[model samples]
Target: MNRVDLLTRSDALARPASIAVDDVSVTYPNGFTAVRDASFELGPGTICALVGVNGSGKSTIFKAIMGFVTPSAGQVRLCGLPVDKAVSQNIVAYVPQSEDVDWNFPVLVEDVVMMGRYGHMNLFRIPSRKDRRKVDEALERVNMSAYRTRQIGELSGGQKKRVFLARALAQEGRIILLDEPFTGIDVTTESAIIDLLRELRDAGHLILVSTHNLGSVPDFCDQVVLLNRTVLAAGPTATTFTQENLERTFGGVLRNFELSGHALHEDDDARSLNVITDDERPLVFYGVKKGKKKPARDKAK
Candidate 1:
């Protein structure tokens, strides 16, 4: 990757200066409320992580922001323009989750990434030299240049994701929203993607990514938005990803295994080893499990 071109790209995104969501809400045809009065703001050069359990409205928020689902109430704005209008101008890019994409479709890696530039180029015009150059640059950014000619079905889960991300980067949007970008990928690929996101943020694009991984938030995100059908919390990771708040959002049943140091409900014994300092008291909660008792720790000790 050319450092000069990357810097130039970043500077261009920074000049734009804004994107925000105002009082957005969504309800399905069956009147099921997926997101209720959701609102947040993201400025240029920052990466925001949106987190929540399954069915917590994270995906719904992304759909609403992208204008795929019309809001039952409120608005989603990008640089003071409606999402649809901003999208038409190629101001934003969206990378949907890998599971959501159909791999059975016949498409090559380069062909998929090149689709990103479709909005900027004429609808019926074949890709020009400049468009192909942009596609190559995007592939290099994601470290997938060599796989340009490869079929999508032949790639691994991580490689397929990189291809989609390359497509988004090729679009050259000022703002990018990725839904669960890290799912099912190896640590190395995940790290590479995170590095790219940081580079993008430093370059001045606003990035919002929804993920289930809480351990990554502190290191990878500038801001964290926790949601469970609503905004449970939204702010810095230190403030929002707290034990108290997490328990409340995820339900008390979903205990933090880090504190207990024992995997939750792993043994049939229903008994877990506890270690506490002299001044500390260890609290153990037991629930009924249908099975035999395992040997105590002393047997192995």
Candidate 2:
């Protein structure tokens, strides 16, 4: 892994986690059940990889954790409280899949990151010195300080991903959730993100990231959760992410490399790729081009 010497949030590092999904089941409005009675415990200072095939409820679970979708059964808790409560406390940060973002909306890098501090501010209050400091620190952490003034629409796929990560950092959240963060990034950006995630983990943050890169689990994540509507297996990477569990989770479609421990091969199945490229999910051009304003509700999702 590449070395990433980045800014640290001591306050965020000192927090504890009670982020757990207890027998959670989510059924959409159309009577489609995405997740079924899934349960897992995520502790502080640990990076847990959420692995599954497409439409396997990974995103649904993330939404439940972020209080976007109310679970039909069971609940998601953070710091021993409900998700909304934890969010009100500004202790949770969520970075949605890049495919869900509308990048054409004109905005500066720093301005975009500053949106993370909205929960911390009172109504109509302007950004304070501390908020600016946090934004600066966050940009530096993601190695995007040089592009702080650049237009959000002018960034590469990898750079856009990094900007969103910087926003999460500026939030100073203890429990961070990322949905398919590596879907459309270059190798260098991927390495940098992995390094930054490790730095955050060592600094006492809890990270739950959904990814298709099984090879990276053993190397960076302390825990792995395999899901296919339910929790097939979840625990330490060494024990829970075995070939047997992967096959069970993927329904025997996962090909295992003999020499690569815990590394599942990506078969020709396009569904397994589950990749959304820039072309597939193009940015929408709307609204008057501007620098920044209070981000809209559900903007992160």
For lDDT, the strongest prediction is: 2
Residue ranges of candidate 2 with Cα displaced over 4 Å: 1-15, 255-301
Please write out the lDDT profile of model 2 over residues 165-184, one tens digit for every residue: 99998888888898888777
Which residue pairs show backbone clashes in model 2? Answer: none
Poorest 10 consecutive residues by lDDT, candidate 1: 292-301
Q: In candidate 1, which residue ranges exceed 4 Å CA deviation?
A: 1-17, 258-301
RMSD of 2: 12.8
The lDDT of each candidate is: 0.75, 0.77
Model 2, residue 145: C-alpha shift (Å): 0.7
Candidate 1, residue 57: CA error in Å? 0.8
Pairs with backbone N, CA or C atoms under 3 Å apart (clashes), candidate 1: 10-203
